[model samples]
Target chain A: MSVRHSMVKGMQNSVGYFISTFLFGIMFGVAAAASGLEQWQGLLMSGMVFSASAQFAALEFWQSPLPLGTIAMSVFLVSTRNILLGMSMTHHFDNHSTGRKILWLFILNDPGVVTAIRLDSGIDKLGYITGYGITLMLSWLISTWVGFNLSNIITIADFGAMDFAGPLMLGIMMVLFSKGSAASPIPWIISGIAALVLHEIGLPAYLILPISVATGIASAMTNRHRSHPPKGETRIKANNND
Target chain B: MTMTTIIMMAGIVYLTRVSGYFIGLQFRHIGELRPILEALPGCAMMAILIPAVRQGDIVDFTSLAVVLGMMWKTNNVVVSSVLGMAILLFGDNVISGS
Candidate 1:
C-alpha cells in the first residue's frame, strides 16, 4: 500500500480502541484536576509525556512538597515497557534515519507499537505507526479536555465496566503478538506465571516486567531444542532464527 | 506539577522509548538472538497482563475469556472489546444483585 493509504489504515485501525483511549484520558484528566493541576498544565503534560501509565502514577504521588525523586522513579519504572517495545520495533525503524526515528518515537504508545508489530512487515509500517500514534495522541488530548472540564460531574464509577477496556486492549495485543510467534505459548505461560509469582513475592512493581521477560526468554531458549529438534525441523529452526 | 517535573518525566519516557531501538541497532548482526528478540513483545504483554487479571474476581476473568475468545474467532479487536465490556457490565450488575 502507499504511505498515505497505510496512514489512513493506521488511523482507521485506531478507531477500535477509541473508547478505551478516551476513558483513559478522562481518568488521567480527572486525576490531574483532583491533584490540583491547572487545565493547561494537565494538557501540557499529556502532550509532552504522552503516557497514561506514567502520568497516572505521577498524579498519584503528586503532593504539596512534591516528592520529585519518587515521582520521577515511578514514572521511569511504570514506563519500562516502552524500552522493550522500542527494542522490539528496532528492525522496523532500522532503515530510517536517526532523526526520523527519534521524532516518530516521541509519540510512541502501546497501541501504536503493538499494532505496528501485528501488521505484516511488508506494509508501509512507518506511515501506519505514525498515523496511529498521532490519532491516539489527539484523542487523548481532546478527552483530557473533556474530563478536565467535567471532573466535577464525573467519578471513577462513571467508567464502570469500561474500566476493563484497557486490560482488554492489552489482552488483544497479547493474542495478536502470540499468533505466529517463534517462542510458542510456553514462553507466554511462563511469563504470566512468573509475573504473578514475582508480584506475589513482593517484588517491586517496576522490576516485574524485565525479570519476567528474562524468564520468558530463558524458557523459550531452553525449550527451543525440544520443540524443534535438529532432525527434520532444521528448516523451521532456521526460519525461526531469522 | 511544575514545568520542570513535567519536562523531566517527558524526557525520561522519551529516553525509554528510543533507547531500546539504539541498543538493538548496536546488536543488529546477531542473527542467533533473533528468536529471543522476536519473543520479547508477546512475553512482555503476558507479564504485564497476568497480574492485573489476578486482581480481578469472577466477572473480570469471565469477561477476559470472552474478550480472548472473541478475538480468536472474529479477530476484530473493537468488536471483541465491546462485547467483553458489555459482558463485564452485565455480569457486574447481575453478580451484584442489582
Candidate 2:
C-alpha cells in the first residue's frame, strides 16, 4: 500500500520502455525508408502521429500508385483503439481545464495509455502523462531520424531483427498486465479468439485489435459476475480483483 | 509527394487520438464501464499477438519462448527484453545457418 506506482515511475523504472521505443522507432524509420519515403517523411509522420504500431501498419499501404484512400482507412482503423483509450482517461482529465485536457488527446500512445491506466491513485496524473508521452515522442522521433539515415549504412532487418522487436515488446507488456489477482487470463483468451475469428472473416488488421478488445472485456465482465455473484460484485477492485 | 502522403497519414492518426478523448469523456460517469475500458488494452495485445504466434514459424515460437522465459525468470521487462533479443538473434542465426 505504501509503495505507489505512477505513470511517471513506470516511465523512469522500465528499461524495456526505452529499448522498445527505440527499437520500434528504428524499425519504423527503416521500413519507411525502404518503402521509398525520405528521412524527412519518416520524421514528419512519427512526430505528428507518435504511434509506432500504426506507423508500421501504414507502411504496408505505402506502395506506389499511392493507395491514399486505403492507407487512410487502415491507419484510421488501427488508431481507432485510441478512442477506447481516451475514454478510459476521461475521468482523470475531467477536472482539468479544457485546453489541458485536450493536450493529452493528441499525445497518448499505447504505452502511455497503459502507464496512465496502471498508475491509478495518489499521483500527479498530468505529470505522469506528460513525462510518459513526451519521453516516448522524443525517442520515437529521434529513432526515426536515425533509422532513416542508418538505413543506407546497415541492412535494417539484419541488425535490428525488426520483426521480433514489436511482438517482444508486446509480450513484455502482456507480462506487466497480468501482475495482480484481478488481471485474469480469460479475457485475453476470449479476445484472441475474437480477433482470429474476425481476421478469418477477412476484416482488416486495423479493425481486428479494437473489436477483439471489446469482446474480451465483455467476456471478462461475464466471468467476473459468475465468480462473485451480485452480492460480492462491489468487492471487485479494478486494480487487481476484477 | 512524400510530404503530402506523410501529412495525410499523420492527420488521420492525430484525429484518432483526439477523437478517442472526446468519446472517452462521454463515458466518464459510467462507473460500470471502467473496468472494461481499463482492461481493453491488455486484451487487445493478446488478441493481436495470438494470431501472429499461431501463424509464425520456428523462429517466432523461439522468440516467444525467449520472451516468456526471461520475463518469467527476471520479472523485469527491460532485462528480459535485452536478454531475450540476444537469445532470439543467436538462435535465429544458428537455425538459418543450419
Best by lDDT: 1
If you assessed candidate 2 against the hidden native complex, which CAPRI class would it receive?
acceptable
Where is model 2 more than 4 Å wrong at Cα? A1-20, A27-38, A53-97, A109-128, A149-161, A180-182, A194-215, A227-242, B1-28, B75-78, B83-92, B96-98
lDDT of 1 by residue, A32-138 (tens): 77677899999999999998767865665566777677667657755766776777777786566778888988887777777888888767777788888888999
Clashing pairs in 2: A16-B78, A83-B20, A87-B24, A182-A240
> For candidate 1, lDDT tens digit of each residue in B29-62?
6445556756665666666677767767788799
Name the weakest run of 10 consecutive residues (lDDT summed) in model 2 chain A. Answer: A1-10
| A118-165 per-residue lDDT for model 2 (tens digits) | 765766565566667777777888889888887776453364444555
**What class would a CAPRI assessor give candidate 1's docking?**
acceptable
Question: Candidate 1 at A178: error in angstroms?
Answer: 2.3
Model 2, residue A24: distance off in Å is 4.4
* Candidate 2 lDDT score at position A167: 64
Report the C-alpha displacement of residue B85, candidate 1, in angstroms: 2.8
